[model samples]
Target: MTPGGRASTAAPAEATATTITFFGGKGGVGKTTMAAASAIGLADAGWRTLVVSTDPAHSLGDAFGTELTDRPRELSENLWAAEPDAEAAVRRRVAQVTEDARSTLPREVMPAVQRHLAHAAATPGMAESALADLLMDAMERVPGEWDLLVVDSAPTGHLLRLINLPELLGPWVEGLVRQRERVASADSLVAGMVGSQERDSADDDPLLARLRERRGKLERAAERLRAEACVRLVLLPRRMVLAETERAADQLSEAGFRLGPVVLNQIPERPDPRVVEAVWRRFEPQGVLELPLAAEEPVGIERLRPLAR
Candidate 1:
């Protein structure tokens, strides 16, 4: 890889196994299409690829033209795809948090909180949090199942907010947990010194327990995302998307991630002089502009192959 587009003598392979997270500034930016094709390309190139859509819209199935359940289904030998059931996902997250909270909260409090969580879980962070949990679960559950995990992400702000969860909430969680732990320890020490015979342990510290659990989960998630090439931008070769992509690139770089590459999902095959191309496009013909206009779905992997690479 060289700035001059000339392959260096010491350059590595043309393609490396990298985690590609697809994001768009807007909904109709073809994030799903680029993600699907990228996954197919990676798989076909002899890399283990898992494509998971965090978008509630769940267009990964439509892109593949196959029945995709909430669980990961084998789209090919090396490729797997999944669209999480957001309802179930929210429930699962809320349940996990509630269960941990129940250890400390009054029994009646959980039921009330659980009812409220149903609607609150429908909010922006809720879905992303659930998806984050699913992502953490995947990394833990199947360590080596995928060499590359391609995340088909939601729209710009939401996706950025989602990925920025750990950094945004980390200090707050740490502070709250630390404060709770200190309070609990002090209360216990005071009780212990005052001759109260309550044998409360760390297990009994619900706030500390929840804090630790949540901290661990978020930390692990952040680690996984920050550890690997977490996100890959899939853009339209249009002006707005390119600007958004640049901003996203800056933010992602700031957030401490190894960005794989920037991919323009769909573009005019012809190099229209009026159209501004990405800096990387050095007078080369771009991808199809009317690609999405085609009625046919996917045209199978063979046809989509051109766009994938």
Candidate 2:
């Protein structure tokens, strides 16, 4: 055990395909530090690792002592890091939707569609949805480009919403597809009755096709998260942090997410053993990896590597 307590030396689990490990907790709990360190450890262990920060307020770049963009940048021989631009992602999604609407809807309806899209772009959770879409793209690159993908997610509430997004939106998209199918069916019947030669099939309708494709993507994303991803919450040993962590763990468990070992960060020297024991007992069955308080902030690859080990 290290001076802090017991430090877990085991690297992240090896996978035949790309496996994702997300480090998340309440704000200011050092989630980014743990995630960066874990990615570095994976890279040192011969796994090609990519660490991405999904938090709108990203500190992953700061942790690496370098700036990062939406695209991945190499930090070491086998490690890369990125802080995705949430605003840009939201704009891209809005533009895509606008283009799709233009192609499928009547010109008279375009104004209304554009207005709705504009409002949606500013609504709550829009950024999270956009970020989730970008994450899905990264997940698709998987074993071919990276052996492991470590995510430094937003604070607990936002992270939980992002995790459950696909499920929440999937059914809504499916309903839209069904509604479109019904409208198409009615149109086709009218065309048949009127002896019109220009009858459109539901399968060939651009709008319905787009909706189906979107629904399929949401389903696949959700499945990959449940099957190939694990969440490791990072928290301090304080009472409030511990209570929040417990609630977050329960929320994750209820959502059918796989929980990895919880990281107990910044354990003080000569701490009360009872507090540590209480944390252990509270998070029983799930291993607790302890990290001692560092003399200085663990920034840069060299400084972070020790914690990784």
Candidate 3:
């Protein structure tokens, strides 16, 4: 879809069904620009749209030539923008989990639990989970505050994992909750034998409750993506980008997300037919869309007009 408010020469019919669009590919493929431009186009079409950046190194503001924050800021009529703070999101999630655990675990052991949680929050997957949370939040607000939502995703790996999280983490979370329940049962048995006061029952375990809550959120997010969202892989004509896009497509297919179309951004004036053919043969996307190389850098909304259509 053209990001700029103009009709795309590629696909017109498909645009009507897409309310949430994810622009993702290898880094430097101009996915952020395309996402921002698409949001502009959607808004210009009279659809209230919010374009959000899940990339930790956000460039949506750079594309629009404006500063942005974690909160949604109005860019123009019917268009808004946001960049969720990944680090802060991670910290907040960890804090919630820790607080819930503190209600169950002994006070003396809470300090060590906090330390372990801090380390766990530093892992790579945590950032992706935080971004997933932001994406889910945006999707849940659809048709309420905005008619359309556009996501400028992180580089290929993170984006793929973020989309695949619910499937991968569902069982793992269930297993953790089960193990915690077993431990709680054993602790209760020991307290009874020792005539010590039993702290609480597993029925009221806060950590287990939190785990179930998180799992439920992820399940709903996965359902929203599968049922409502369309994923578009953006790429340049370079060999590396083509190969990466192919891999991304395969992963998306495996994860059960419907692939929308392949967007070829920044096409040169003298395009290579060979490069185009190679992508068509190997990428095999449902549809293909192209954006011409701009005469100058596409910075502001005016410069992005040609692409929007």
Q: How many residue pairs clash in each candidate?
A: 1, 0, 6
TM-score of each: 0.78, 0.88, 0.85
Worst 10 residues of 2 by lDDT: 1-10
Candidate ordering by lDDT (highest first): 2, 3, 1
Candidate no. 3 TM-score? 0.85
Top-TM-score structure, candidate number: 2
Off by over 4 Å in 3: 1-16, 181-203, 281-285
Candidate 1 lDDT over 1-309, as tens digits, reads 222234546646444433445544456767787778878877787767778887777878888877787788887777888987877988887777787777667797877887877778879768767776776666664336666677786555654564577778889988988787777778789888998965465668766776778777777666666665445566665766666677876776686776655555455555443444452552233232233333444545565677775
Q: Write the number of the candidate with greater lDDT, choosing between 1 and 2.
A: 2
lDDT by residue (157-270, candidate 2, tens digit) is 665665676678778887898898888888888888998865576656877887787667777877887888889999888888898899999988777678988999988896
lDDT of 2: 0.82
Model 1 root mean square deviation, Cα atoms: 6.0
At residue 253, candidate 1 shows an lDDT of 66
Prediction 2 TM-score vs. true: 0.88
Model 2: residue 287 alpha-carbon error in angstroms: 0.9
